[model samples]
Target chain A: MRLLINKIFLALSILSAGVGLAFLAWILITLFMKGLSSFHFSLFLNDLIEGGLRNLIVGQMILAGLASLIGIPLGMTAGIYIQEYGQGRYAALIRDLSDIMMSAPSIVIGAFVYAIVVVPMGGTSGFAGAIALAIMMIPVVINTTDSMLSLVPRELREAGIALGASKYKVIIDIVIKAAKVGIMTGILLAFARIIGETAPLLFTSETSNYFSLNLGESFPSLTVSIYDLANEPEESSRDLAWAASFILTVLVLIINLTGRFITRNKK
Target chain B: MEKIFQKLSLSSATLVFVLLIGIFITLYSAAKPAIDEFGLHFIINPDWNKEIVVETPSLRADTVANDAEDDAIADEDDMILDEDDDEMLLDDEDDTVTKTIYGGLVPIVGTLLTTIIALTFALPIAMGIAVFLAEIAPKNISYVVGIAIELLAAIPSIIFGMWGLYYFAPIVADLVGGYQVSLLTAGLVLGVMILPFMAAITRDSMNTTPAVLKESAYALGATKFEVIKDIIFPYSKVGIIGSIILALGRALGETMAVAFLIGSIFVLPKAINDPTISIPVAMANNFGEASGLGESALFYLALILFIISFAVISLAKFYFLKKAK
Candidate 1:
C-alpha cells in the first residue's frame, strides 16, 4: 500500500510539474504568435502616430538606464552597510524598513512620487518617473547585494584585516571583488525588475504621445505604451502592444539568462 | 574621509527607513481631505460618485431613516431604471447614478477576491515546481529548470497584463464561454505572475533542509513522498508561510496587469466571471481624471494598500531575517 501510494504521489507531482511548464509555454507561444503575426521590419522604425513601437523601445531603455544609475549606487551602499556595519539596533531597524519599502506596491510609490515630485513640479516628467522606478529598484538591489556580499567567505575578510587593511579597504578590495559576479547579477536583476514596471511610470512619466529624451517632459515607456495601446479599439494598436510585449519579454529573458550565467559557480 | 565614507553608507541605509515613514506621511497627508469629509465611512461605503449625496454611517443604524432613504432610493432607482437598465451604462455619466456615493467597498472586495483567487491557483503549481527542482530532479536538470523558472520572475508584470488583455483573457473567456477580461482572468494572470516568488522561497527553504534527515527517512524504509511530508514541510513552515505572505503583497499591489484583465468594473461581484476593479487598478485607471475628493480617494486606496502590505511584508521580513541569521 505504501509503494502504491508513493507511485501515485510521484505521478501526481510529475503531472502538476508538467502543468507549470505547460502554462509557461502557452503564454510564450501565444505572445510570440500574436506579436510576430503583426510584426514587420517597419514595426521597428515607424513612429507611434504612424503605427509602430520603436520610440517606446528607446524610451524604455532611457528610463531603465536612468533608474539604474540612480538606484545601483544607493542600493549597493545600503547593501554594504547592512553586511558590514548594520549590526546593532539601528541597522536592524533599517534592514526591516528596507524590506517594507521593497514590498510596498509600485503604484503606491507612484502615487507618493506624484505628490512629492509631480504635483510640486506641476506636471509629470521622465526624471520623476526615473526616481519612482529607482525607489522600486533600491530594495531589490539591497537585498541581492546583502546576500551576495555575505556569500564572500569570512576568511577572505579576516585575511584582509590581518594584513592591516582598513575595514573600508577590506570591503572594497576583498569583499566586493570576491562578490563581483553575484553583485553584477543582482544589479542586472534589479534593472530587469524596473524595466517592465508600469505602475511607477504611470503617474510620474504620464505617457507622452511622442518620444522625448528631456527629463523635464513626459516620456514614452514600453509598459505604459503597451497599456495605452492594448486598450485601444484599433487592430494596429493591439498589434503594437503585442510587439512591445514580445520585446520586453525577450529582453528580460536575455538578462535573466545572463544573470544565471554570471551566478553559476562552476567550482 | 574613510570615516565619512562609512558614515555615508550608514546614512544611505537609514535613508530607506526615512523613506518608509515618508510613504505613509505623503499618502495620509494627501488623503486627509477625503478622509475628513467621509470620516471612517470613507472606507465602509461602496459608492464612488461625483454628483451623489452621501448618507452618514451613523444613519445606517436608524431603521426609520434607512426606510425613508430606501423608499426615496427606490423611487430614484425606478426613475433611473426607466432611463436605463444596464448598471455599467448608468455608471458612465456621474450625475445620473444614485446618491449616497463615495464608498470604497467595491474596490476593496474586488482586491481581496482577485488576490485570494490568484493565491489559490498559484500555490499548488508553485509548490510542485519547487519540489521538482529542489528535491526530485537530477542536479543538472534542476539547475536548468531553476534558471528557467527564475526567468519567469524576470518577465515584467506589464507584459503579463498585455498578454492577458490581448491573448490569455480571450482564451479563458472562450473556455468559460464568457466575455473577455473579468475577475477570473485577472486572477489567473496574477497567479502566473506570482508563481516565481513563492516557488523561489519554497525552494530556498527546501534547499536548507538537512540531507541527513531525508537520508534517515529513506533508510527507515520511508518513501520520497513520506520524507518530504514528514521532514521537509514541517521544517520549512515559517519560510513557506513567509513566501505566501510575499506573494500576497505582490498580488494585492499588482496594478497594470490586473487593471488590464479585470474589466475595471467598480461594482463588487457575486460570481467568478463578474467584472471588478482592484485598489491599485482603481488608482491606475482613474487618477488621471480625478480631482478634489475623487483624487484624494485614490490616495486613500493607496493608503489602505500600504498599511495591509506593510503588515504582510513585516511578517515576511521576520521569516527572511530569521533565515539570514
Candidate 2:
C-alpha cells in the first residue's frame, strides 16, 4: 500500500509537469501552424496592411532597442552604487523603490507616459513609447547588475583597490568584466519583456496602420497590432493577428533560448 | 575627493527618487482635468463624462436642457428651487466623477477574483508536481519534466493570448456550457499561464525541506503520503505561500491572455462563468477607442491598475524579504 501510494504520487507529479509542458507545446504548435500559413517575404517587406503588423515589427524593434540602450547604463550605474558603495538608508529606499517599479504593471507605466510624455508632447510618438519601455526595463537591469556585481568575490575588488585603481576603474575593469555575461543576459531578458509588452505601448505608442520611421509620429508595434487585429471584425485581420502573434512567439523563444545558452555557456 | 564621490552617489540615489516623482507628477497632471471636474467622487463612482461638458458645448447645453425639464415638472416653487438644487445635485453628481478617481474597485475586484480562481486550480497540481519532482519522481523523468515546466515560463504572453483565444476558449466554452466568453475561461488559461511559476517556485521551496526531517518521519514507519503531509508541507508552507503570492501577482497583472479570453465587458459580473473585464483588460480595451476624456479615462484606469499591482507586488516583496531574512 505504501509503495503503491509513492508510485501514485510520483505519477501525479510527472503528469502535472507534463500538463504544463503540453500547454507550452500547444502554444508553439498553434503559432507555427497558423503563423507559417501566412508567412511571406512580402509580409516583412510591406509597410502595413490596414489592421496588419508590418510597421509594428519595425516599431517594436526600434522602441525596444532604444529602451535597452537607456536602461542598461542607468541600471548598471545604480547597481554598482548599491553593491559596491556602502548600503545606507537612502540606498535601501532606492532598492526598495526599484523593486516596486519593477513589479508595477506595464500599463501603469503607459498611463504614466501618457500623462508625462504623450500629453505634454502632444501625441503618441515612438520616443515616448521608448521612454516608457525604458522605465519598465530599469528595475530589471538594476536587479541584474546588483546581483552580478555581488557575485564578484570581495578579494577581487580589494585586489583592485590595492593596485591603487579608482573606484570607477575597479568597477569598469574588474567588476563589470566579471559579470559581463550575466549583465548581458539581464539586458536581453529586459528586451524580451519590453518587446512582449502590449499594454504599456497601447496608449503611449498610438496604434498606426502603416509603417513610418519618423520617431515623432505615432506607430504600432507587433504586439499592439496583434491585439488590434485579433479584436477586429474581419477574418483576414484575425489571420494576420495570428501571423503576427506567431512571429512574436518565435522572436521571444529565440531570445529566451539565446539568453539561456549564454548563461549556461558562461557557467 | 571621497566627499565628492559620496555626494555623487547620494545625488544618483536621489535621481531614482526623482524619476519616481516624475512618474507621480505626470500621472497627476494627466489626471488633473478629470480630477478637477470630478473631485474625490472619482474614487467612488464610474463617471467617464467629467470633461465632456467642457469639451463639447452641445453636451453642456444638453445637460442644462435636461435640468430645465426636471425643474418645469416640479409643483412647488421650493421644489423648483430644489430642482435647480437638484441640478446642483447633478453638479454634485459631477463631484462623484471627481471622487471616482477611476473607481478601480470593480477592476481590482475582477483581478482578485480571477487570481483566486486561478490559484485554486493551480496550487494543488503544482504542489503535486513539486512533491514528485523533489521527492518521488525518478531522476531521469524528473529532469525532463523540470526542463519542460521551465520552458513553459518562456512562452510570451501574446502567444498565450492567441492560443487562449483560438484554442482554449472554444474547448472551455464547450466543456462548461455554451460558447460564452467568461471569467472561467480567463481563469483557466491564466492557470495554465502561471502553472510553471507556481510549480517551479514550489519545487524549489519544497526542496529546501531538510532530508533529515523526511527521513525521521519515514524512520517512524510513516508512509510517503504521511511524510509529505506532516513533514514536507509544514516546513515549506511559508515558501509555498510566497510562491503562490508571486504567482498571484503575475495573474493580477496579466494582460493579453485575460483580455482575449475574458470577453471584455466593463461592468461587474454576477458569476465566474459570466463575462467580466479585468483592470488590465480595461486598459487594453480602452486603448484603441479612447480619445479626449475617453483617453484620460483609460489612463486613469491604467493608474488604478498600477496601484493595484503595486500593492500586490509590495506585499509579495515584503513576504519574500521576511522569508529570506
Where does candidate 2 chain A have its weakest 10-residue lDDT segment? A45-54
lDDT per residue, candidate 2, B239-314, as tens digits?
A: 7787788788788888877888887766666877888778788877776566655566655656656666767777
- lDDT score, candidate 2: 0.74
In the range B12-108, model 1's lDDT, one tens digit per residue, is 8987987888999999999997776666766766667634422234444564446745644543444354344444444544433334336688889
Top TM-score model? 1
| Total backbone clashes of candidate 1, pairs 3 or more residues apart or in separate chains | 3
Computed on C-alphas against the true complex, the DockQ of each candidate is: 0.71, 0.51
Q: For residues A157-254, could you state the per-residue lDDT of candidate 2 as single tens digits? A: 99999999888778788989999999898888778878888878877886677777888978767887788778788888888888887788778768
Give the lDDT of residue B121 in candidate 2: 82
Provide the TM-score of chain B versus the true chain B for each model in turn: 0.84, 0.76
CA shift of A165, model 2, Å = 1.2
- RMSD (Å) of each candidate, 1 decimal: 5.1, 5.8
For model 2, the stretches where C-alpha displacement exceeds 4 angstroms are A1-8, A50-54, B1-13, B32-105, B139-141, B211-223, B287-300
